[model samples]
Target chain A: MRVLLVDDEEELVATLAERLEMRGITACWVTNHRAALEAVDRERFDIALLDVRLPEMNGLDLKRLIEAKQPTMKFIFLTGHGSEEDFNACSAESGREYYLIKPVQIDVLTAKLHEICAEQGDRQ
Target chain B: MNGSHGKVDTLGLDYFGRMTASISHEIKNGLAIINENAGLLGDLVALTDKGRPLDPARLETIAENIRRRVQHADDIVRRLNQFAHSVSGPVTTVTLREIVESTVALAHRIAAMKGIAFTFSQDDTIKVETIPFILQNMVWICLKNIFQRHDSDTNLTLDFAFQEIETDVVIVMNFSHEIDTAATKAAISEEGKPIILFLKAQIYNDQTNRTIQLRMPKKFID
Candidate 1:
């Protein structure tokens, strides 16, 4: 699946992208919202993995902007320090299935990606 | 001092939690990178055969990356420890520059998320006896207020000048955008105002010049 990764942590994003590639997934990553936006404009990504605390904009805000641009593009938020309150707030605003805390297991992430893709395919 | 003690305590706890969360997130990101690099190295090893030699250069690069992340995490933990210790003593003698620097470090992640650059200039050696925790909280509140009002590209300059004749230190925060008086007033109201009173510090906002000035006495007595 084609995926877009957005995070300010350059090393994390780069490494994650390489691992995803190793797993036979095509992943493109960027470190800021502007670059993420530009990447979305330039390519068709099936899903965008976004870091909640971003450089130019927070992940939730960026999700909204990207959704406006590509309504069908799916999103999964990554946060390193999300409290219960933050989780509840995000869930209340955007539902529960889209958020993931950091230090996420690659296998779990891959499983979620597959699940999201399957869900999208079913919807289509 | 008009706010309730419970409210002040809650605010301090909230600030502590927020800083801790941010710092932990930073450290977690560092660890995540190291983890990913290690995983990649494992993948490389698995792909190697008994007859073929593993690329030592690639292995060295991954190890170096892990080491760098470890050092980065250490720095973050050090800053977090310093921040936590600031509240240990109710009252202490602290240099204005030191507090500003510490507060800036504590607020660095928040500012970085908004793409705001903080420039601090304090050549004068000005020390004051006060509650460092409360002072730090005051500065953090002011920064949060400013960051919330301004855009990501905004640059903030904090300049410290000591008035020897008046025996006071003035901290001027200069930004590009015009100060939102209403929002600024709200930020300084309630819990924030009480802390300012507790610190015996006076705050002034110049809308025309887009500057916020904080004046503090050389000595604070409870």
Candidate 2:
């Protein structure tokens, strides 16, 4: 599956992309909302992994922008802190299944990706 | 004034919480990078078992990256510890420049996130006796306000000068574009009056140059 990772933490995003690539998943990462939007515009990504606390705009807001451009694209939020406010915010959204906390387990993340794609397939 | 003091206390705690959260996020990001590198090493080890030749340079790069991240995390924790100890004494002799530097360090991440260039320059010889925590809170409030109002890519300069005649230190915040000086002054007065009063300081907007000036005495009296 092709995925896009967006976070201001450059090393974290780059390393996560590398790990995902090693696992046979095609992943591309960007460091901010503007670059993320540019990436989405330039390429077709099946899923977008966004950090909840981004530079200028937060992940939730960026997700809306991306969804506007790519209606069928899916999103998973990555947050460093699992505060109740963050959880509630993600849960209130339509795509709640993919909100993962930072320092996430790679295996669990992969499973979630598979589950999301499978659900998408079933809907189609 | 007691009610105002209570408001300053609440705002001080809020600033403390925000700084701690931001620093913790930085440390966490460092750890996340190290974790990924370690995982990559494990992947290489697994590949080696299948007769894939090990690249020593790649291993070295991953190890070096982990070391750099560890140092990054350590620096963040050290700064955080310094910030936590800022409240240890109620009144102490502190260099004005040092306090400004510490405050800038605390707010650096938030500024960077917004792509705002926040810079500060001071005369190292200038000293003051004051409540460091409250001083930091006041400065942080101003910074937080600026970041909230301005968009990304804005440039802000904080210039510090000592006025010998007045025996006061002045911090002038300069912005690239014209801001609502009256509104900013009002906001600072509304939210920060207690601290300003407690510190026996003055803050006003200079409409001529579109700058906000925070003036504090060289020594404060309880």
Interface RMSD of each: 1.3, 1.3
Report chain A TM-scores, every model.
0.94, 0.96
Error of 2 at B175 (Å): 2.4
DockQ for each of the predicted structures, in order?
Answer: 0.75, 0.76
Q: lDDT score, residue A38, model 2? A: 96
- For model 1, report DockQ: 0.75
Give the Å error, residue A10, model 2: 1.3
For residues B105-199, what per-residue lDDT tens digits would candidate 1 score against the true structure?
88888887775666655554777777888788888888888777776665544444444337777766776555584568466654487677666
Model 2: lDDT equals 0.82
Model 1 iRMS (Å) reads 1.3
| lDDT by residue for model 2 (A1-124), tens | 9999999988788988988897889999999898999998999998999899998789999999999999998889889888888888887764567788878888898898888888888999
- Clashing residue pairs for model 1: none
